[model samples]
Target chain A: MTTAIARTIDAIWKMEAARIIGGLARRVRDVGLAEDLAQDALIAALEQWPAKGIPPNPGAWLAMTARNKAIDRLRRDANLRRKLDELGHELEDSAMPAEIAEGIQDDVLRLIFTACHPLLPHEAQIALTLRIVCGLTTEEIARAQLVPEPTVQQRIVRAKKKLADAGIGFNDIAPEDFDARLGAVLQVIYLIYNEGYSASSGSSYLRLSLCEEALRLARMLVHMAKEEAEIHALLALMELQSSRARARTDATGTPIPLPEQNRNHWDRLQIARGLKSLETSRNLGGPPGVYYLQAAIAACHARAVTPDATDWPQISALYSLLFELTQSPVVRLNHAVAVGMAYGPSSGLQLLAPLQTEAALRDYHPLWAARGELLYRAERHAEARAAFETAAGMTRNAPEKTALLARAAACGQ
Target chain B: MKVIVFVKATADSEAAVPPTAELLTAMGNYNEELVKAGIMLGGEGLKPSSFAKRVHFDGPNRTVIDGPFTETKELVAGFWIWEVRNMEEAVEWVKRCPNPMFTASDIDIRPMYGMEDYKEWDKEGGWLEQEVKLREQIEAKNA
Candidate 1:
């Protein structure tokens, strides 16, 4: 029973910690102090809840507890007495104020933007966002990204200290910079999702929690910035890609190539959600951004009930638009694949040939894999076998390596 | 909102032994109740920490440490992600779970943040239209 209660408290803390801290940060105007007060509330819950039974509204309970702690702390500080007087009435009230409750989402959004501040390094932004916004422990963040816990700890600590030293307020993002800041925020979220979707170097192909976290954040962003077509596009792209997660790997966790995957395993709900978001982006009525174009390409595949039914021409067209928008060699490589599907192996090969020496694709595994597939389709078995072997050697993911090696063997046969 | 209920690892779980059939049946029945109530989103058991590894990072340096490192109390054995109205509803469901261990065990519940929480941020006023439509599509697809 003691263990049960302890676990319950632990769980509650993980869920409410961010919100509690975010709320207090708004009230206190100090992230570090807000976090400290929230931690105090957690400790209090740990000490009191097991004996008292869990509170009725655990989140509100924690927030109220933290608010009281903040009030007490402020009362002692001569400099903060005026602030304390301002907050005292609300803190003393048992019921949380409606405005405070309504502002929780804003607080979280502010917290994420602050964590991903442009002044901070990319790694620090990621570490800080995972810790503060996602409520992941240092150890869990380390494990998720395959970094050392202390390294993650250092990044988080340094990030916090940097923000404090820079005198960056939680609401520092100016209105004019909202679009640029939103771009940074979207980039960080997409990076996390991509890492989860295709781990840079891991045995597993998917990390559901990271993907879910990214999706959750994207959903939140869309809600926050309703008219932002790019946000909707990004969300649509993630949803479409994530819909294929269940079919991306075999029963034994080995990756199955897209063509061989059982479409029945595709998450129809996610696909529906993706398509809906895509429609919203279209309805918003602007030229398609990179994400929107990619989402359109993904939609082409998702709309197909079978691999053969896929609209390769539409996908190829979307890729061309994506290439024009981003000028990314990776996009071009993907476009090559679509071209191959729509046109012929030789046409795909012609597109792939330019990218082979494009510097970026030289050591990229997918580039080699695509080349191998195109070559195999052209009946250039020996060259395809060699390309498959090179692709197999370049990849670090275990499942991807296994699939590549299997493809290489098929080429030999 | 969704909540993830974590089942804490016990000494037996740390030892990597499977649960007894009776205990499994009990847990299954509990899961069935959750599903029947339309609360369960997903659930799964985890392998022992023996298969886990921790990477310690020091700036640019990294060192790996093997798991099964004598911290049974801190490890997770399994978890169930449930969609519930609030933390209170989740707690009520958790209170009915059978003991998940041969010995003493504990379950913890944490709520998942949702897009609805930020609905007020729609300054231009149509921000949540897409999200609402998408959610309905998801519900219909699931149904």
Candidate 2:
């Protein structure tokens, strides 16, 4: 019975953390405090849910409990009369229809924007997004961020104070503001997904948990913002990329390039979901955001029955569009590769030449690795070897480092 | 050209944070705006400070600062790189941003070192070659 209760609590936590936090944030107008109150609610559930059995509406129970905790905290503070008065207006006379308070709301969206607010540091935003928005533990977030756990912890603490000081509120974004809000959320989710896809600091080739969390958040966003084509597009992009998780690495955990990955090992379910989401985005009849465009590009690959059948021209065009939209160095780099595949190595090299000035790419390992491969395909073996060697030196990941060295050796062969 | 957009975190270090609906929605909206405006390079929230540690050296002795840090306000949460026209433009864009914290928070902007400052080093072929090579690798890998 206890085991069953524990399992139920786990599920509830996963499904309700965002909602609980969101509701509390609205009440307190303090994300940090809201989270604290939510945790207190979670703790109460942990302690009593087993004995009480699963409540008919677990989310509502949690919200009510958290609300009570917030009230308690306010009462204890003594000088929080203004806060209490506001709460009185917000929560007063409303029926405690446990279902209504616990239902899926826009709080998660609000939380994402708050966590990604301009006042916090980038690292802090990532950490806070994972923790408060995605329900990840600090240790888990630290592992995902590839920073020392303490560093992630400090950033989160500092982030909360920053949020508090900024006085940002938890509210629905106006229709005019929705696009920008969604973009920020997508950026954070994409960052999380990328960190999992190509971890910056960990020894492992992938942290599946981070990827899963990102996908989950993307899915939630899709559900909450059904009218937003880009939201579905973002989810589609993540799902398509994530479908290759099994084939992205070997048994020994070495990285596997897309061309080498066994299509049979790809998760067909995820692919189908991705394709469906892509279709949904397209059907919405609006200019798709960069993620949507990229998802369309990803769909081109997903739809291809074989690697050789890939529509490189279309991908190249799509990437070109992305570059026009964002002009991001990263997108330009990707465009160079797509152009190379669609056109020729010479053309690709020309595209890549200008990106040489991007300072952030200086120590970035993939840049050299990609250059080496392009050089290899162009039959510049010596240069390719040098490029790969350089990449190996820049990267700290053992497997990636080994892969670069092996690629360098192959250039000689 | 050297605009730095501050992105502070919103979780307390010493205290464990659980999610609330309001927080989630705000974060989502804010991130969307940042992306739509193309001001976002990269951003994320951090874990709390207790799990944080800093390595420092005082002369011959090396010191590590373990969290929870004493001052929350003094700590930086997160940041972004924006290639705006100038600091003023960056500030204007920032001025429109919603407050990060539920109470009150500030975002700091700092310019990065530019080519002119690194001219002497560039002449020495410092990291340019490496950068190009890395870019190539990433392209090939992604391709």
Candidate 3:
């Protein structure tokens, strides 16, 4: 019973911590102090809840507890006493006011924007957002990102101090800079999703929790920034990609290439959701952004009932547009695959040849993998085998390595 | 609104043992009811985490860890995405579900965000109008 209650409290903390912090930050006008007050309330719950029964509305309980702590701290500080006066009767109120309660959503949104401010280093921004907005412990953030716990702790500390030094408040960011700030926020979320979607160094291809968190954050952004087409596009791209989680691997956990994945295992609902979001993005006007183009490419695959039925020409066209947008070699590599599929293997090989000496493609496994595939398709068995072996050796992921080695072996036959 | 209902993994689920025929039939019948009521949009069981892996990131560095993770409570056995009117309605529907496991189980329900949640952001003309029209187009295309 004690363990169950403890578990419940922990779950509630994860769900409510962000809201509590957001509300307190608005009340105190200090993000750092708000987080500390919220932590104090959480500590209070950990100590009391296991002994006493859980509260009826744990969220409200935490909010009320944190508010009282804020009021107490203010009363003790002479300089902050005037700020306390500004808090008015809302602090003394027994129940949470309707407006303050409704403002919680806006508070959290503002908190996210503040955390992802362009003033902070990109790494610091990501760490701060995960810690504050996601309500993740430093240790959890460390584990998820594969960094040392102490490093994550240091990053969080420095980030908070930097924000305080800059005198940045929850609503301090200007409307004129909203787009630039929103761009940074979207990039951070996208990076988090990509990390979860494909672990660059891990044996597993996907980390569901990270992906889920990113998707959740993206969904939140879409709700908060309904005017942004790119937000919907990013959400659509994630949903469409995530729908393939099941089909991306075999029963034994071996990696399954896209062409070989069983269509029946795909999550149809997610596909539907992705398509809907994409439609919303397109309807919102403006030229296709990188995310929208990628979603369009993913849509091509999702619409195909069979691999052979895939709209390669459309995908190729989208990738070309994407290439023009980002100029990323990775996009070019993908474009090569689409070209190979749409036209012929030789045509794909021609695109891949120029990329071989491109500095960015030096150690990229997919570049080699694509080269191997194009070579194998061209009936150049010896060259294909060499290429697959090189690709296999480059990849750190076990399942991918196994797949590549198997392809290499197949070339010999 | 849409919500995801997660069925937490247990020791038996972690071991990858097959469910009994009775349990399967019970779940099938329940899913049918959900679909018939248009509550369940989609759902599926997941393979055990032993077949899973984790990749940790430190800056640009990534470290991969194989799974058979010790934390069963944190593991998910299956999940369903359902469209419902509100959290209360979702909870009521979840209460009707047959036991998905041989032992005691826990189900966690979380709300999925919708466009209406951002009504505050609709003040600006251009994009919000397009979002609603596009959503309608998607529904029509799917329909």
Top candidate, metric TM-score: 3
TM-score of candidate 1 on Cα atoms, chains taken together: 0.69
TM-score of chain B of 1: 0.77
- In candidate 3, stretches whose alpha carbon ends up further than 4 angstroms from where it belongs are A79-105, A200-207, A396-402, B1-143
Model 2 DockQ reads: 0.01
Worst 10 residues of 2 chain A by lDDT: A199-208
* True-vs-predicted CA distance for residue A141, candidate 1, Å: 2.2
List runs of model 1 lying over 4 Å from the truth.
A77-105, A200-206, A396-406, B1-89, B92-143
Native contacts retained, all candidates in order:
0.00, 0.00, 0.00
| DockQ ranking, high to low | 3, 1, 2
Q: lDDT tens string, model 1, A303-343? A: 99989999998899989998998899999999999999999
Candidate 1 has an lDDT of: 0.78
The order of the candidates by TM-score, greatest first, is 3, 1, 2
Tell me how far the alpha carbon of residue B98 in candidate 3 is from the true structure, in angstroms, after superposition: 22
DockQ of the two-chain complex in candidate 1: 0.02
Cα lDDT tens digits, model 3, A82-117, are: 654544443454344454334333787888887887
lDDT head-to-head 2 vs 3, winner? 3
The CA lDDT at A245 in model 1 is 72
For each model, chain A TM-score? 0.86, 0.83, 0.88
Q: Estimate each model's TM-score.
A: 0.69, 0.64, 0.70
- Model 2: per-residue Cα lDDT at residue A405: 98
**Clashes by residue pair, model 3:** A145-B57, A202-B64
How would you encode candidate 2's per-residue C-alpha lDDT over A1-413 as one tens digit per residue? 77756655765665567778988887777889899888899899999978767776677898899999988888888655575466556545544444333432467767777888756777788899888876677886777666898998898889998876665555534445555666777888888888877742224433655766777677666666677788889989988997776566543446678887767667786698799989999999787688889999988888887798999889989998898899778888888888888898888888888776689678878778878888899999999899899999999988889888999999985
